[model samples]
Target: MYGYIKGVVKKVYPSHVIVENNGIGYLIISPNPYEYKLDDEAIFYTYLHVREDVFSLYGFKSEKILNLFLKLISVSGIGPKSALGIVAFDDTDRIVQAIELGDVKYLTKFPGVGTKSAQQIILDLKGKLIDDEVEIKLISDAGKDVEAALVSLGYNKADIKRVMKHINVDQSADQALKEALAYLLK
Candidate 1:
């Protein structure tokens, strides 16, 4: 029910952070908790998870990433931990790339993912992400071309725009387009 939390960081560990809002300290689990520092004023996109025996807060730096995490956890075989691992290692683009490429090997590298889960991720999430929202770090030559080809192939302009945004100019346009399309399609 919480939209976001603004607070001073009380402590930071490798996998968790404590943020003080008002007089209370909230222990939040995150993919890269170490990226934050003590005493810093920070805003965390939060997910409050309540179960019979546990209540936990999972936090992320951006709302986009947090939405992706929520989507990941909705898959049948994926859990919060697996979703966090995916976010930890892959940005929005890369995860979409892995899904578009049907590269189970790359996906399985994340903690707690295996062959079955990887396949499930691909099956469940393919074509489900908003093309404009996928974020990736590296755009290969192949990726560029694919994106352009998709535009030429009669895909939606918004789709092309979103895909193009993630492409790195250093990559050949054709290849970057391809990778972008892969992410977009995913």
Candidate 2:
């Protein structure tokens, strides 16, 4: 039931960050740990996923992302990893919009989400965000090429997601490719 943790980042892995607080390091699984740097003091709005044998902490840099993750995990078939992957790939706002619009096709594009699950997401979450006043701003089509380029370069979707914050989808596909490559290589 811990709500948040403000600590210094001790390390950043591909899927999680180690945050140190009160001489204890908390391994918080995050969608994009690369957004944080070592030794930087920051606050993580968090959710602790607890089950019979599995206990893990998931943290987000922003409340919007945290809330979105919570909503995704609440769906019947979606787990924390699936929910994290969806948001990690920049599909939060898009998922919200798809659910709102009853766009099952768009919902199925997310990893681990099949037709049945997409329908469930739409059924469970549609009209949910409207009451919360969450805005939906999906990225442009250029993201496909950028994602493809990263995949072609042997970077998995999870790894590519860490660099997405630096990309601007307003540019052409080629530009997004180059920008994403530059960031990934660095």
Candidate 3:
């Protein structure tokens, strides 16, 4: 029922943070607890996960990531920790792209996702997570082509993602690849 919490960070831990709002402290499990600082004012978009005897409050820095986590947990073989590990290690855009493109190898790179789980993620989420028009317009097909080309050249996802931030999505794949290579070589 907690949509979000605006509070001062009271404590920071490896897997969670304690946010004190009003007079109570909330134990908020986060994918990246290091993102928060002690005593910093922050807003955490939250998800309350309730199971048989455990109640957990999972938190995300952004609503988009929170939504993606929700979608992940909906898959039969995926659970909260698996979903957290996925989002914690990869870019959300890349995750969506892998799902849409049915790239099982990329999905399996996540901590808890195996071959079967990766396939299930594609089966359950491809063509369903993002609208085609938004996907094409925002992260243009050309951009993805450039990313695939870079991956083929033995570059890691983190480096490719770093260069991608400098790429102009509107450009042709050839042009984008040239720009990305220039950035990578520097």
At residue 52, give the lDDT of candidate 1. Answer: 91
- Top candidate by lDDT: 3
Estimate TM-scores for all models: 0.74, 0.68, 0.73
lDDT of 3 at 176: 87
**Whole-model alpha-carbon lDDT for candidate 1:** 0.80
Model 2, clash count? 0
Tens digits of per-residue lDDT for model 1 on 11-100? 998889999999999899989998898899999999988889998899999998998899889899898989999999878777877776
Q: If the candidates were sorted by their lDDT against the true structure, best first, what order would they fall in?
A: 3, 1, 2
Q: Indicate whether candidate 1 or candidate 2 has the larger TM-score.
A: 1
Task: Between candidates 2 and 3, name the one with more favorable lDDT.
Answer: 3
* Cα-based RMSD of candidate 3: 10.6
Give me the displacement of residue 87 in model 1, in angstroms: 0.8
lDDT of every model, 2 decimals: 0.80, 0.80, 0.87
User: Judged by TM-score relative to the true structure, which candidate is superior, 2 or 3?
Assistant: 3
Tens-digit lDDT track for model 3 on 49-118? 9999999999999998999999999999999999999999988888998886677999999999999999
User: What is the TM-score (0 to 1) of candidate 2?
Assistant: 0.68
In model 3, which runs have C-alpha deviations exceeding 4 angstroms?
Answer: 137-186
